[model samples]
Target chain A: MELAKMEALIVDDHPGMRTAMRLTLSNLGVTHSQFAQSANEAIRRIKGQHYDIIVCDYNLGPEQDGQQLLELLRHNNLIDLSMIFIMVTAERAYEKVVSAAELGPDDYLIKPFTAEVFRVRLERVLQKKSAMAPLFPVLQAGDAAKASELCNVLAASHPAYMIDFLRIKAELLMGMGQAEAAQQVFEGIVSERAVPWAKLGLARTLRLQQKDVEAESILEGVISESPEYLAAFDTLASVKDKLGKAGEAQEVLSKAVAISPNTLARQRMMGDVAMRNGDITAAEAAYTTIVEKGRTSFFRDPNDYVNLSRALLECGKNEDAINRLREGRQSFSNAPEAVFAASVMESQAYSQMGKAAAAKEALGRAMALKDSVPMTDELKLDLATACYRSGDEAMGARLMDQVVRNRHEDARLLQRVRKIYTDLGRELEGEQLVQSSTQAVVNLNNQGVLLAKQGNLAGAVELLTEAAAQLPNNQQIVLNAAHAVLTLVNREGWNQDLMLKAKRYLEEVRGSNATHPKLVQLQTLFNDVQNKYGSRV
Target chain B: MSGQDEALLPAMLAASLHEVKNMLGELTLSLDALQQQCPQQAAQIEEMRFVTRQVSDRMVQVLLLYKNDAGVLRPNIEAIPPADLLEEMLMEARSLAGDRLVVSLEGEQAPPYAYFDRYLCEMALMNAIHNALRFAHSRIVIGVGRLGNALCFSVEDDGPGYVPAVLQRAIEPGGHSRDGGTGLGLYFADRVARLHCNNAGECGRVQLDNAGVLGGARFQLILP
Candidate 1:
């Protein structure tokens, strides 16, 4: 409560709040403080003095909000490690809270406050800080285990701080895969009232448990109600995209970007969707944004460069696309897949730009460098285009066969594969290849039906699983496989590989149908699997 | 900067007021700290403190009106605890009201956090506390926690409550109550409340009504 010991900096656009706040602080025994009228001045004051506290307003100016400024300070590590940063805000905007929370400030105070209220709020923050102060060194050192122990000790003693403490404990439990404990904690919050974050957190835990339908539904509910909740939108989009609803996912993600343009991952996601849907313009827009904005982010994925550059090649911006990929390859210290992707992209660009000879030459080098990159079905689909363009009909046909085979039961992917082969004047081959894979897929479905009818559940599961492996994108193969296994699983209860195989196949099914028809039954089986085999994943 | 510059005069006025508001905030915090260091000189600093709060309160009021037009005022409602609401409101009230007022807790303690736009509610209470501090001759009292069917909060001043005309206008966002206020504070509050309100049923708001303790104004916000 002594003003002499406390050092503070006040940042606000309003001179009067600063004055009144200063006078009020004086009356309450806080005398020494610095003042800044705007964010620019605040940054200057922050640099000039090591203030014990910083009071910033949420709405700073036209260009930079308080949240953005705080991020800048944090990214730069301008504040001392122990600095008690607080934002003086009056706006109760959700975007502000999310952005504020995302930035991870120490504490924030709203405007037009009296001395008594200020003291109480400060006291609460300081008390929380004091409790954590002893363990701060370990936390600062990034020792989660030690910090968890200290926090756990504090939590057990202080039930008043249980909510805050358990929030951290739940995160640790989640991180440690202590699902049963974390579930009880989350369910406690849920039974009382729905905390969106806790709900989402639990939903994430369910996702880790491979309960895609439950996770997707929770995220969707949050998204529908809180349209501006960007994270929820992203999560829902991710679930949808993973579930093979690329179009729906694209629409939702596009809406999120419209609200608050996702700087990196969202852009990459959008680009991937655009490519899948064959909207080269959108792919270019999203990819270009990611390449420009996310190059320096810790969350930077080299796939953005690869995907965006590929889009550019598809749109016939060969030189620009190749250049972007080349620069990205040099800049990013990522996996070998990135380098391989660059080579693939470069080869595609060269061939598309009418330099077929150069294209093969680059492909030769890429193939030589890496024995073979297990190109994703997406990459293979694109690479087939370059191969066809380079006049390698046999090679192109072979690659197309694999792509079509891998995604046998996926109508959209099948259609896409057909279109690719069609564009290359290989309609007959594409149709024939898809027919073979599709027939095999149809056989597995029929076998499962007959076996289940005949009570040969084991045979039904085995045959369906083989069919699913042959058609990674097929839901029916996976759905029936899980169904057959679910039937067999109870009678033949939790055999490791069989349940694991069933689980893997179910994920593929869920990846194609986030809300699959047979998901509820499958979840019960998954729960059984977890109960039999502890939550170790 | 646009070609139809004359039509944008109001925007310029708003921007100017924003700048003035920033100056008021800087002065308020700086002087309060100075006043604390020089506690013996309370008589000399009270005028500065009063003007600081007045200017800040008015500037905040103006900004509240302008906020609806700004790009960042999107309200996302959540199930907020009454205690969280009180905590946010209390922080704002104390910071802007100065040492002249006493903001405390009252009523049965509800959940600490609520499902409301925490940021928006904070803004509304700030303006309410500023008004309380301006009117009360000696002391202003704020009691928060909960009251009735919903979590009720009140900011009471020993001074007289709102006059009828002003009270009516205060209900409307951007409403001008007596040539004195920009009337933006209450208007913004109403808009903010409506944002959280359900069109299917019920209202979510920060309202200025009778404190029930005295004939003083009580700003009650109930979120369902």
Candidate 2:
């Protein structure tokens, strides 16, 4: 495409900088250009029109920075990946460099540059974009294999982009689930030069292959060598979490948050890991930061307020915890889970403060909404604890029994459930209950499996489906039911009822235990069934 | 200063420098537009613009060195095609010189890409090019190619080479013999060069030599 004919958008909050960029863009022979003073305005323009090039300033003032804007644009699929996006900024510090590099813009230009410098950078980006223009359609169509093949051909033909092409090729390989090939490509790049991004790519490939130790070592080297590489920290945190070192994972996330606290996802991760490790203070701080920073992010969740109040209560700050719960209701009253979790937390707080009457009243309110509220296992645990402390032993035992039956194999969650009963002076009873509940679920799963093997797929699915409803917290039972339903569907040839049941089972455990061994296989099966039979239904 | 205070000083300086750089950018735009209308006085306007650029370049150098000294400048090493880097350097040199001098990129045409921090390398080359523009006799040339195992970027001019006394203390930043020179330009170049370490753990180095393509002083930044 001709340089002058392509449209451009210049985004900078400072008018002087915008005017300067306009002159620079005009000098490069770009006649059609637009300016936006903030990321919001830029997004509106971007959504309304398709500009060939966008020059965005890194600091877009308060609404959203360039990085967040780019993330939102990419995340929402509002902009095609092929557009030429150049990040311009005055800060050349490693902080900004790391943040911008993580986003992988076409080019980045530091400010205080001459018009000549601007033109040279923009032209280089345009050259790279135009060279890869043919592959954009395949990539946008989500044809990973086709995109990888086309990228290889284009890289061989256009040797000038061989290095960048290799990087893209590795990424495409990863997207296509060819982690071994991606690792090979990344290894080749790292052997040539220990580029941090390439090293990180290799680490991610190793991670995809479940080589957590190898990925963790490489990630450790990356962050130590380049302290400002925030993504490495995040990767290392997850790797540690996978390795079952929740404390280390929390530490890694804390380090990352120390460097860049505005990332709400990292803050949330930090809170989760800290809570899992039982570091109430750390979890409280992380959740507080999340609540504060989440105001500007689209990722804001009402759960943060609930988690923050729970953490405060755990830290024995009853007054502060009560205040947080009150604030959560005021802010997120529309979310039913938030309101229910708030009542549970309030009951627990009041019980801990020796206000028996108030605690009993709050627990009643929580129990009254039990049928209306969609319950997660964590919420069940909270309500059970509240009920036990508020002198509702029978109700607490029922809820705790449900938790034990559903997650019998989850030792940590089982331990937490046992603790609720033990704290209520029923340790022996809780142990017996846990043992019996676990045995019952195991027997049900075994029988279901036997039925499937004996060609009684329908009977197996029926048994497991009923078991899943009774033991809703049992992921193993749910997955077992899903598998039996798929087996039954395979035999019966597209049963809409079985497909819906299988989908419901899979949906229950979607984000929870996504790392389960059979989760991916089950999801793939469910998707295949939907694709093959969804239309007829 | 305490470590925390030392770390904050560079950020403050960079922030203030950002404001100054924006103003300079605006001034350059106005000067560039005015130079077009009044070609008769283009030389004087170009000279003023050169000074503005130099001031901005100095601020960048200072901020970079501060970050480097505080151990905060982690080089984002990457495989950079030399042709693109030199092309960019030549463009900036052309704008700074306007019609006063000729600027061109010379040497290797293909990509046996050099691994370095592209931004810092570009800034270092711009500094070298700016220095060459001040001393060159109507012509400046930038050379990019492999020198043995190192990737070398050199700016050469037709003007007289560096004096013997200045050459003696060439590598010592802030130790130059000249009173007028800030001595920061070469210092930044050397710092950036030294940051690029090879697999063998050998850092890069900078060199000063005369009688290059232009037969004047050649400021070479060689990275391993």
DockQ of each: 0.21, 0.39
Off by over 4 Å in 2: A1-12, A15-54, A62-64, A71-80, A94-96, A99-101, A114-116, A172-178, A354-375, A387-409, A451-537, B1-39, B148-150, B160-170, B174-183
Compose the digit string of candidate 2's lDDT tens values, residues A275-303.
88988888989999888776656556767
User: B119-192 in candidate 2: lDDT tens per residue?
Assistant: 88888888888778878998998888887888888899888877777677756666662335767888888899
For DockQ, the strongest prediction is 2
Q: RMSD to native for every prediction?
A: 8.8, 5.0
lDDT of 1 by residue, A113-180 (tens): 55776777666667666655666686567554455677678866654455666667666555444555
Candidate 1 backbone overlaps, count: 55
Worst 10 residues of 1 chain A by lDDT: A94-103
Q: What is the lDDT of every predicted structure here?
A: 0.67, 0.80
